[model samples]
Target: MPESATAAPPLQVSSETAPLRQVVVHTPGEEMALVAPGNKDELLFDDLLFVEEAREEHATLVRLFEAAIGDAGAEGGAVLQLSDLLREAFDGADARESFVEALVELLPERNFEAYEAELKALGPDALHRFALTGQAPFAVSATPLPNLLFTRDLSAVVGDHPILSLAATAARRPESAIIRTIYHHHPRFAAARERLIELPEDVTFEGGDLLVVNERVVMIGQSERTSLGGVLAVARALLDRTSVEHVLMVNLPKERYCMHLDTVFTFADDDTCVVFPPIIEEPRDHVLHIEAGAERGGDGPREFRMRPLPSVREALEEVTGRSYTFIPCGGADPIRQRREQWTDGANLFAVRPGLVVGYARNRATYEALARAGFHVVSADDFLGFYGDAAAASQDRIAVRLSGNELSRGRGGPRCMTMPLVRMRNSES
Candidate 1:
């Protein structure tokens, strides 16, 4: 078949395959070494270890995903590598210059000339090391990208547009740069350049904080990483470009565990989601809905406004046009909710409508999923099913991972895997 004949797929909203059409992932790199004992907190991680072993564990994840979703170069799906995407983005003179300029703007304290020269000379592997280590060759100082392993936190897709995230913390800025470069330059996504949205100024957003429940509705978390301004930027972009009717901005505590929306909530199916009860149920907590302007040329785009919504429960029901069952993470116990939420219990990745993946360490959360009628299975089990032709037809299964060490870095399975394509519901 001709390349042009291969039409781009339609966007889906489920974690099963929305926002994330093509994801750029970095297998754990030398950057993890920067998370020293005393600097763990500063790095936004709880502990540090060898990069080689981490890479090995991460490789298992990549293999499982490839087996399940298929590789980009192969038949079923696509997986865009960060290194390849970065190289493509830096291909042209204009793009390269623009990127270097952006990098300089981000790191004004450093000597631009030396930094540029050193980065230009490095190959992909060396560049990966440089980006992770934040090491400069000459007089310039480098800033380490410690959290790149949590790829889901860097950037996200809202509808068909890719929004470049501005992390709320300084520790994650390098990740933003890498993602920006990738989206700006990758050939696989060249068609999306005109649709790219960025908040290079005061706004801050993270993929972990934004959830595209559908083309018409998005769920945003007002947490440490995503700001009010960022939400507005995303809202404006969606309103201007798509038929998004509502942006549900959920206010989360700007604390350690509740750093992003995904830490406390994720979609399980079109009409169901997992949530932390305290925020979703508390009447005092602020949750608002910003309606998108009517279709372009209709009503001249309402002045990008926001209004307080009922409750998260009600808001989701209203937007989805159906009442959803809220499966509380950490079972029904408030104590378990607090404890497991801290370890990313609510952070689950949906591979298909009813199939999700998360950290197995959250035992209470797993039980809750089971209680909710989900067939909970370990990562190994899920991988086994995928590898077996006989079990491939099964639809409802949760892929659980041994995320004790990984989750200490403030993320879970959802934070790790980025889905590219999803099987759409024929009835929808």
Candidate 2:
């Protein structure tokens, strides 16, 4: 497909646990392989990952995602690939100039003339590959976007709105640039331009830090990947444009393993959440409750009511009406908790109310989930069993994908998924 020329349907994502209908993901390619062991730290990777193996793991996610949704072409939904969107944006109608201009704006002024000259000569197909691999058949120095495969960081789709995130590091800038361009020019999403909330400069909020609880509430984390300003900005925007009434700000420990909220927390059902106990149970952490001013105002001087929360657990319930059963990331053993948290054992992407996708390597976390009444199954089993329809064990299953090699890239299922649409409960 050249592009989603059919005017893809508008996206709607309100609850984290609603059935995941459509999502965006990127397969690891040359850019991912460019991260050498010596410079891995600079690229935010703990170790070098086997790109081929990681690509295979990502394929499983796409298959599982598509199977859960039933059909790719049905209801204007599909597992939209990031590279494919980039290709369409560069190759499709009147998209070249727009995409190039957006990309150049992110680069330094001195290099703009050179990049523009080189980018124009490459044609649409080369330009698409350039966006991912940062390489070309021709000559040019480009920023290696090693972390693009972890597509969850670029932007977020919140209740009919897409918020493009600003980058925290120079290496990750291309991720945002491509995401912004695709949403603005791609025929699938350009129509939502009016509803899009563009993040301000240096706010540095990634999607992993932004978690939607329900239409009435959103929870953004103050973690390594997201700043205080980012949380506040998103919280305010959600209140202004969406049905979100309050934003719960959970402060995380400044640690690599706890880089994002999902590294330590994620919803599994309406009344359950998988979490790393230390962060959620720590007394020293902060949880701020941000609400809009007494009256409603969109373009006027907005007033924000801020207060410190006694606890994020209780405050979240107040907003979503669910006293969630907290399932520890690892089992009760502290040693296992620290071990599993390092591998993002807490980061499980909820497919629906009680079904989810997680890494199979997190044995301790798996044990915890099993105890919490989740039927753990392999991705192969889930896909084979369901074929092309919803699973019979839909509400109480966890589809575990093998991530032995992919885990080296330092993200789990939720980190790799950028959910664009999720079905709202019919009863709601």
- TM-score of each candidate structure, all chains considered together: 0.87, 0.93
Question: Which model scores highest in TM-score?
Answer: 2
Indicate the residue-level lDDT of 263 in model 2. Answer: 90
Q: What's the number of clashes in each of the models?
A: 2, 0
Q: Which digits, one per residue and each the tens of the lDDT, describe model 2 over residues 37-151?
A: 7778877888888888888988988888877776433245568778877787775645767666766777664265576866766788877777776777766766567788788
Q: Model 1 over residues 127-154: C-alpha lDDT tens digits?
A: 5456667764545566567687788887
Local accuracy by lDDT, each model: 0.69, 0.81
Name the regions of candidate 1 deviating beyond 4 angstroms.
Answer: 1-22, 50-53, 70-77, 87-96, 110-128, 283-285, 293-301, 388-394, 423-428
Distance from true location, Cα of 89 in model 1, Å: 3.9
